[model samples]
Every structure is written in C-alpha cells, then in structure tokens.
Target: MIDWARLQGVYGPAHDVPTLLQAAGNGAKEAWDELWIQLWHQGNTCDAGIAALPALASLAQHTNRAVRFPAIELAGEIVGAGLREGRPLEKMKELHQPVAMLSALADGWLSERPAGYRVCFRAKLALDGFPVLSDVLDDFLDFCCDVSCPQCSDKVSIVIGDFGCYSSIRDWNLGDVHPIPLRPAAPDDLQDAAQGLHHAAIRDEQPRLAWGLRHVFGDAECGTCDTAFSVLSALEAKRSPSTEFQENAGAATAPAGHDEGKNRHWPAPPF
Candidate 1:
C-alpha cells in the first residue's frame, strides 16, 4: 500500500509545494512507480485515489518546466484513464481543485515573464483541458488578448481557436476576453516561411523545394496549376506516398473560397 505516512512525512510543514514539485520532476518515474505500487497494493478506493492528488498536482507546478509539463500531462492521462474504468466521477472532481491551483500558477508565470512562450503554451493547454477552472480560463484568455507580440498573439489565437472549437463546444464566449485582429503578414512572412521550411526539412529530411510546397499549398491543388508539382519540387528528389493527402485533410486547412464574412463574429483560426 502507499505509505501515506511517508508522503505526509515528506510533506512536513517545512517543505513547500514548489520544492516537492521539483523533487517529483527530477525523479518522476521513481515517484510515480512508488505511487502505482501503493495503489496496486491498496486496491482502488476513493480515499487512496484522492490522496495521490496533491502530489500529482504539486508536480504540475514544478520549478523545472520539463518536470512541470509532463506532470500536468500525466494528471490529464490518469484522470482520463481512470474515468474510463467506471471510477467515481467525484474522485476525479477532487482533482480539479489542485489542477485549478496549478493553472493559476501558470498564469502568474506568464504574467511575470511574457517571453516564456513554452510556459504560456503549456498553461493554455492545461486550462483548455480543464474547463472546471473557469477563473484560470478567464485569466489566460485575458493574457492572450492583451499580449502585443505577434508570436504571442498567434499562440493565443491558436489556443482560443482550439478551446473555442473543441473544448468549449462552439462556445465562442469562452474566447471573449481578447478580441485582437490578426496582424497582416509583413515582409518577414517569406523569411518566416523559409525558416519554417528549413526546420521541417531538417526534421523530416525532405527536399527544400518539396517542404516549401507542402508548407505553402498543402493538399489544395490549384485548379489551374498543379499545386502538387510545386510541393513535389520542394521535396527535391524524395518521394513519399500521397495516399494520406486529401483536399482539406485537416481542420487546420482553410476551406476553398471560405467566406469569413458569413460569421458576424468569427473566432480567429487556431494557428
């Protein structure tokens, strides 16, 4: 069984949440292994499940971003898997309090250091998955709306679009806080595109020309011209099956001749 006494002992009055989270991140596998061992021996019970909540939540706010990111991710995984097993929803509800607390911490991190894109991104991701934390949602959306940098704004737009579409179930109000229009592409657009192509080429080992086409035209073959030709050229000599490529294959793809004016207040596209 989990050594409740040991966990409580480690959580003695002197050790703060941040410290414990750091420890958990540095030794997550070990810590989680212990937790699982305890859970397996103790049997699945409400109290036992609830007791693990605090430690897991603490890890979500670890000082090390690497540790904190995975901890938050793991919490989501555990809750999702546990819920599927017919576990009591109330036990999962108990986890919300801590998750919300971590969300607030993430908000603080973003506010204090706006350049920490990774932190802001992960925070948005966490809040998107945990709708019960309405307060965190409010703060995060507000931050996205107010942040002036295009990169930051893009991230915000992406998060707002994603949450608005998937998590909030078409509830645009969830994205009401920031109402900034997307900035027009500047001369830097080509540079940014080239850079994106370079990164993709490096990561996927595709030809520069093919990568460019895939980045630009995607699956929409220009009716007048072979858009696929351009994409294939960017790929250089590399050849891959196009079986998975479909016209407008992913939600990220813009609809052909899409009318933006149709919606009175269209939420911006998630980047």
Candidate 2:
C-alpha cells in the first residue's frame, strides 16, 4: 500500500531518491550511480539538493544509525567524487554550492548543526588542490570557519607544506628521539620514503612521510611517491617468505646438472 507517486513527489523530481536511499544501505552500485548523477547534475535543480539534504542527513541520526549512515556517506562521496572527476566548475556558479551541501552532510554525521571547521579544512585542502576554484574555496571556508561552528576547531588540524616534511614534523613533535630529517629526502631517500608512504596509505595507515612530500613538493612528486610505494610493496609481497620458500624448494630439487651451487661453499640462509 505504498503511495509511489506521493513518495516521488515528496522526495523530488527523481522518485529515485528513496531507491537510492535503499541502495546505499545495500551498497547497490546502481543506486550510488543514480545518487551521484543527481548531485553531480545539481544544476538541474533550483535548490541544488539543499532543501532535501537536511531530511536525508536526519536519517543518519536515527537510533539504528547504520540505516542512515550509508545515505549520509553517499552524500559526501557523490560531491567528493564529482569534484575529483573534474566536473566543470562553470556549471556550479554559486560560491557556496558544494561547501553548503557538504556542511549540511557533515552536520548530520556529527549529530548537530553542521560545524564549518571540518568543512573548511576539507575546503582548504580541495582549494589547495584546485586553485581555479579559489573563489568558491574562499567563500565556503569562510562560512564553515564562522563562529557558529566553533566545534570544528576540535575536529580539524592543519598541516602546511610537503606531506613528507609534515609527517616528519608530526613525528618529531611526538618526542621521537631521532626524527627523520625535516628537509626533502635526498633523491634516493625520497624514492624510499615515497615507497613507504604508498604502502602505508594503501594499508589504511598514516603515510606521514608521503604526506610530507606531497604537501611540500606538490602533486607530481606525491604521485611519483605513491607509484613507487605501490611498485615496491608489490615486489616485496612477491618475494614474501612463502614465495621464497617455494623458489628454494624448486632449486633444491633441481636435476644433477643444476648442482652448480651444491659443490661450492654455500652461505647460510639469513632466515
């Protein structure tokens, strides 16, 4: 006895909102895509999802929080992904557009009126990444950092310059007896640090060194560092203990002619 038409009217032009809401719960790819398309094409709506954001975010605050969590997360994912995809900024002229939407979503996540601190932190990072969007960044960060959202101060921290250096700074401040040098790593050292950072980030660990490099050296080096880390991690995994054991077993069982090393003085294996 669900009134489908009434439900669609209540949600918006796209009766798909409820479907998307449900899909988010189940991790339905289609539902996610639909939601992304709506937010991405926010230009199609007069209010740009502003009116509906609050209600949608409220669902995340329910007693059964899981039911609403996905919906709330999807909201941020859509916007963040859209921006990352390099959507044309001309389509979103209002300086406060994405910021406002994101602020509301963050508010719902925090279970209170949206504090602008986290939003401003994200906005600053986003702006730092996309300088062309400077005006929007300025307005959004300003609004979010306003006095009303003082709670943001507790939630956000700023680290300036090169990801690797920043990581080093944080480590140093943490009372590490011997902190990694604060300057950019030497070319080879940078390569090694980059590799380390990549593995750390992939493993969902903090890539302090990598972050410092990115924050200091800029995107190109940061990307190189990530690539190096990925390649190194893969190589290391390929040579893991089990893999080494299998290779050694194969060598030990080789035919007589392959006994070249068997007659020589063999060094003891490290392990």
The models' CA-based lDDT, in order, is 0.35, 0.33
Tens digits of lDDT, candidate 2, 1-271? 3333333221256555656656655656676566656543431322333333444455544455444444454444333433444545335555345445544444334333234333333332332232212112221110111001122211111122211111111121332111122233333444433443333333432244234333333211111121112212222223232223223221111111223344522222221
User: Per-residue CA lDDT of candidate 1, range 130-222, in tens?
Assistant: 211111122122112111122221111112222222111112433333332222222234344334333433443334322222233221122
Clashing pairs in 1: 209-234, 209-235, 210-234, 210-235
Error of 2 at 159 (Å): 17
Candidate 2 lDDT score at position 245: 26
Best model per lDDT: 1
What TM-score quantifies how close candidate 2 is to the native fold? 0.28
As a whole number from 0 to 100, the lDDT of residue 102 in candidate 1 is 51
Clash total of candidate 1: 4
List candidate 1 segments past 4 Å from native: 1-51, 80-96, 109-271
Model 2 clash tally, residue pairs: 13
